[model samples]
Target: MSTTTAAAAIPAGRTEPDPDRVARGKPLAHLDGVPVYGWRGAPPYLRTKTQLAASRLKVTAEQEAAPLAYVRTRDYGDVPLHDPAAAVKMRPLPSSTKARMAARRTCSQCGKVRPVVLRGRPCSVCRQRAEKAEQRLRARTCAGCGTVRELPYPKHGRCHGCRQEQLEAKRARIDAWLAEVTVCAGEGCTKRRGSKKAARAWLKQHDWLLSPANPNLPDSWNSPGWPRRCTPCQKAHDAEQTRRQAENQARYEREERERRERERREAEERVRWAAAALADPGVVVLDTETTGLHEQARLVELAVVGSSGDVLLDTLLNPGEPVGDASDIHGITDDMVTGAPRFSDVLVHLTALLDRKRVLIYNKWFDIARLRHELELHYRDRAVREAVEEADPAEVAPEVLRERAAAEARLQAAAWLDAMTFEDVMIPYSDWVGEWSEYHGNNRWQPLNGGHRAAGDCHAVLACLRAMAEDVPAASGADEVSGTTVGEGGPWSRCA
Candidate 1:
């Protein structure tokens, strides 16, 4: 009978309720007026169950996807989550909340509160007051009398009396130190001190060590006696001596060169006088232009015209060297004479033309000097070489050799100015023409058309000669035209 009451017949498929749900209890819906379960609510319950299962699956997936130790919660509109701990207590309002909160703050410096109505910015009275106080503190005060005083803003901190006193004290200290000082043994050291200790201190300050034998002297100042000079002074003196020596050497060389030139010129002048005596022509004009005013400058161009102002054998001779300053005045560019004949090529023609013809020139000394140098060079190269080659070494004695050399040099120098200068011919011609023109009431002695061109210059000289010839008085067997009066048709009419 005890067994018969058997546990109400259990259904074959039925099982026990979940143990986890029994422990956790059923979850409640957030919506209002919703039942947990029943027939009328069965559909919703089933649907909720299905949705819950799906939601559970999503939550599980989210949890799996989320970073470790992270939690997720649902949001309810307009309903804050109740914190269990806070719900247990009831606290009073804080003091900060009970007071009327300030919208605009008051300035600490000026005690002025800003109005809430003003929107842009607050007042800066505190900052402005701080800046003005700083400026006042920086304003000048008299240092001597300790009184506040007005001064230029730039010099606001210093008073005139204090500044002057500081300068005077510095100067007095410097003078005192200078007066007590002695020259140091060290090179270029002019430092002074009052005592041996101070001197040692100074040497130590300057990183100098005292000599072992002479404790007063620095190691670098070990020379036997007082130095002839300090390093800087010695350097300057040596430089000056070098400069003076260079200058003296230059001057000596210059004087020697000038002496040689003078001797050559004298010999050339003698030869010119001899040539003029032999030729005895009516007129000869010599002209030359040079590269520079130095003895070494080469001749660029030369011209010799006759009394009739004719260029007897006019030729452009190449100097065989660079044309320098001479081209500046003469306009003889290198291109103008590139294919011109060399001086050596035209020398024979030049010499033949000058035979029995007086030489004339302006500034004869300079012209002759340059000519002499050029001719001497050519003659030595030509004649001296020939003589040396033809003579026997055994027969050429020392005296004879010397004599031959001297004679050749003289000949070379002579050729430079033989009937080839203004002094010998042109000057006399000019004088004669001038006098004759003046006598005839025609005082145009200078070359015509300013004489810039060579042809123009020769024409001027020819004109003068013609005038002179016309001016000559009639002589026995002279033409009637020459004897005619000045106003009549005659030589004078022809000259005019």
Candidate 2:
């Protein structure tokens, strides 16, 4: 509640107005029918509760405020105030006021409470003592001159001359310890008046003996076969060992370099051979759709298409196991291959188609490993059948006879890999483009019509090879193949 606006009119003759002065004896703001002065207008003699306590004045909340002065605000029309003189003072100090002030004073340096001053500061005595200690730390006593001197680098509170003497003494002690023991038997050893057994034991514990089998053998007291040497002999032996190790390491590094060079040459030759075969009419692009990518996964469909768009072989195979999750990738379900011929049945046909041809497969490492594994499985089953029939010595079935013959021929075919090398098309393609993309997924390389199947992938491989070949320059006069240059472009394009 605010005081009535009529209360804002003060008695005219009481005081003059000054903007800088606070609202003490002047109206500021009215709050709930009383005037209140802002904090900025407060007077020193008119104190708040905290100010009064800090002044050691006793004030009670029950005592009413005295109207010793008037305060006003816009929020509160009129307010009353109290004077500091009305409060009771606390008891006197324990000592004189000046002594108490000196006791409470702190030195800037060393943080000690002292009633001493020099140049009007409390730390004069402490500063003088610290300067004397620092001067002493800068100098050290010399062992040779027996006089205090400064060192190049302070260590153990000793000067340079003292440090040199200490080092010489340490080396002499080490020399005495060395002379007391022998490292090898064949040596002009230094004589010491110590027990021979104790010397030998000490040498052994310190690994001072050499062994032909264990190069770092330690000396032993009762080991007759072990050889011991003096310090000089040990030094010579260590030097010789280090030299031999350097020679062996150099020889090993040279041989490794030669081996890598030979491998590089051989790999380049193989790539050249594959590129030459690519131009031949017998070269075929092979692709297969398998149940999965694992070693156990079997082929569901196989495609062998010539580079010139000739379909040599395309057939669905009953892999003898369920297709499972692979059906989604190749779109070849169990129902599709239910009555299809098995890989064993088509072995003869496949080998005949691939016999003397340069088989260009995508990712040949995977396809070759898988093909060999499948053949191994077929041979294992045939061997079991042969072992069972060996007791009766009955006539072998023609199908069994054909499978055994095909498996053996294919095993021999592994050797022909030198001439009819199964080249992976990805090698040359990636070398030309410097990158790879998915052939089956929706990407730039993926076909608009079909992919992830044997036939579709075979066509994709052909397109990729043709694209790479096109980048090569054509030969002098031959233009039959797009990039078939006699000396310029061949079957493969060289990266720029």
Candidate 3:
């Protein structure tokens, strides 16, 4: 059915809306005897043009199938709403559009079809040829020596070397008259001028006098700025420049040698240290994966591997905090560690394991600081629990008691940390690798290939130690270190 009024004309082929579906949303008004609804108030049968477009569909033209109704939206207000059933799939590009695109792809100069739009310029190949031609116009071979080089004057080409020789000839006249060096070599007449200024003015007159002899020679040599030097003086100047260049080259080579020797010494020292650490029964590799890198970050996992390849300890430690932001990295979530023991529960066992032993940790400083923070938290919680149980209303305020507890906990935590011994494996490894960072004034730290988990990272540290302990050849030097290549098989090799 079709409806036409002065206000609007209803389009045909609009699917009839079910009354049951109509009950879903309240229809606004029958404006000009046609259904009208606001954005959220439209019936299920009604789809706006945007909704149709999103589905790769278009509303059929008024001649084909008209809109079922209208929807009033905040932006682009009162757009027609059509039944999706009456909408058609979007049509492909027309022949005129294809022709226009083809024209754009055709190069303006070469007239060849290109992968990209030429944008009024020639294709890449034609453009390159044109650029080369322009370069050739601006450059020419020197008449002397025949080396193809850029010349300031391409028409009367003379390379810098040849031009310098010509300039020296002009300067030789000045030196001849001044009695600084050799006699004049000016053609036809070899008389000397009075002062340096008189000689320069006369030189220009001489160029005009002898213009036919050197018709192609540039007039730049006749300028006042032309540096005057005799034949012997020129030889001495060239010799000084050559000597200075030789000295600079020697200095560079000396510096390079010193740098290489220094690095070799450092690498040998690192290897020795690694060997010592490996031989010592006290040294053990330790690693931990935590909630975060922050001081307050709690451990999600902890592991220790003895030098003798014994797995000393490996367990998950629940921090009782949701691993929301950091779970993606270490892949530990709240559910995974829900039943695991807290840091407080594992403190005594950890202390026992590390007693009278040297713990080697990758990035030891950060991990130790993190461990101290955990300890502080544990003591604070213990103090708070004890304080809460023995609280008296008359004694002090709750906040004041809590503050005192925290302060005491920090002191105890510090004392506990002071007793343990640790060494940074990352520092020695970085020194061996020898990539200097100017910002830090130290070697750049390498990433731990096996650091995704606590146990895996412990193995990675041990692997690094083993790699360092091996005899490094002097010739190969410490050019580069790769996590995968250095320590072939271990937890580090898992990724490779």
Write down the TM-score of every candidate.
Answer: 0.31, 0.38, 0.49
Residue 84's lDDT within candidate 2 is 65
lDDT of 3 at 51: 82
Task: Judging by lDDT against the true structure, name the best candidate.
Answer: 3
Query: How would you encode candidate 1's per-residue C-alpha lDDT over 351-433 as one tens digit per residue?
Result: 77766655555445766777777777677567656777888868886567656765797686695565543443344333333
Off by over 4 Å in 3: 1-225, 228-243, 385-395, 430-445, 472-496
Better candidate by lDDT, 1 or 3: 3
Best by TM-score: 3
RMSD, each candidate, Å? 37.7, 23.3, 19.6
Write model 3 residue lDDT over 1-496, tens digit each, in one string.
Answer: 3344732543465655666357355557765566677766666766777888888888667712455666766887666777777778988779999888989899998788888987677898997999998767556766667677544454446677877776677566455544531223333333432346654565567676334246343323443533445455556777988999999999999997777566666666777788888899998888888888776788888889898778988989888887767889888889999999988888898999887889899998888888888988889888988887888857878898889889989999898878889889887776656566789977677787984888888888877888778645431453444312222122222111
- Off-target runs (Cα >4 Å) in candidate 1 are 1-284, 387-407, 415-456, 463-496
Predicted structure 3: lDDT: 0.72
What's model 1's lDDT at 338?
73
